[model samples]
Target: MAVKGHGMEVKDHGMEVKGHGMEVKGHDMEVKGHGLEEKGHGLEEKGHGMAVKGHGMAVKGHGMEVKGHGMEVKGHGMEVKGHDMEVKGHGLEAKGHGMAVNGHDMEVKGHGMEVKGNGMAVKGHDMEVKGHGMEVNGHGMEVKGHDMEVKGHDMVVKGHGMAIQCHGMEVKGHGMEIKGHGMKVKGHDMEVKGHDMKVKGHGMKVKGHDMELKGQWYGGKRSWYGGTMSWYGGKRSRYGGIVFLNW
Candidate 1:
């Protein structure tokens, strides 16, 4: 069936067009202009109760549902079930999930979940993340009531008996703390006050010596004069950097 614009084209058992080239083919239907296209076994749009089968379903605005096989959605009460699922904003809900997402009231249930923003709630295994006031329970606990930002590098903090209170955070590696808020590390070693952190490999010492040390061989003993040491490589050890002395 072939129908073109500006009204009136008709064929029984399929092919009905009225204004702006709307086309319908017996079992394989197509409608143009305002953009509505339908094929056999499932397709519905605009009124928002969208349906599609054997995968590939799309819905825009309010209460969306897609069953089985890779589902993708955009805005307003988004829902996805089983197999490579992707979702976008507003009261987001995912079941037996897969993920690639954008923000707003997030909720995810089981199976390789990926992340985005806003009032987060995640339950059950495999979580990958983005931002916004977090609360994660059931074996992969990330409970941040105010703020959380994780920039990756195999960062792991697992909890069952939780106690994490930070005014600020940035961990480069090993044994972390920022009481009175201040820490920055580039090697090992830690201690801070006021706020500043920078380190570049081995032999670290701080006693009110407002920091700044660069690579290779620093055999400690500089109290408050812009620190220095030389010969860059491994083994001549003792870095343990980041002990802020009011800078």
Candidate 2:
């Protein structure tokens, strides 16, 4: 048997099986929130699987995966909650952050892969694992924040998978890798190739700047690019202005 949830909620359940295979896939099952939550025993020879791939506020178990075969049993994301979440493959991949009123914020992510006669993989953003006599792989990524009352500017941010926030800016990228700026003010520009990067400032400023060039010169009076000269803050004061020269 196979079960999957695209846009719905499945809750509260018990199961018992012998000499058979069972599969659970997609959103909430056997629990209060979204996805499948397993409870009970006698699940011998039972195979179960679950996947949650959607853009919604399910509130629990964003992307969780579970698989079982033969007399073996495998479980992932027994408990989950948050938004923009994802759990993929036979292993669990919990990614994203939880909310907090006046305390610390929590975030987690997990990724794994395995292959063998009897292998298992469980991954989560804020993840935990337990298995035996099988090949198991697990990975987690998390970020926690403290209170802002004492520090005056306290902020907590977490992401189980990959989290990006643009308070007042723009970003562009493709696939898992990203290239762009988190925040840009005026005339400054930047480019990068990686998984994550953040920028914050105002007026012609590049927060995370990376430049590669050959044959650059800085003159005493002003900056010159071959024969053309330009000042960063305008051509008014020579001593208190910044300049850039390209060749």
Which candidate gets the maximum TM-score versus the true structure?
A: 1
lDDT of 2 by residue, 8-103 (tens): 111222111111111222311111122222333111111122211220001123332221111111233222222212222322222232111112
The lDDT values for all models are 0.25, 0.19
lDDT (tens digit, per residue) of candidate 1 on 70-119? 22222212233332222232122322221222221122222111111111
Q: Clashing residue pairs, candidate 1?
A: 5-21, 7-19, 188-240, 188-241, 189-240, 191-243, 202-239, 203-238, 203-239, 216-230
TM-score of each: 0.20, 0.16
Per-residue lDDT, model 1, residue 84, is: 23
Range of the 10 consecutive residues with the lowest summed lDDT in candidate 2: 146-155
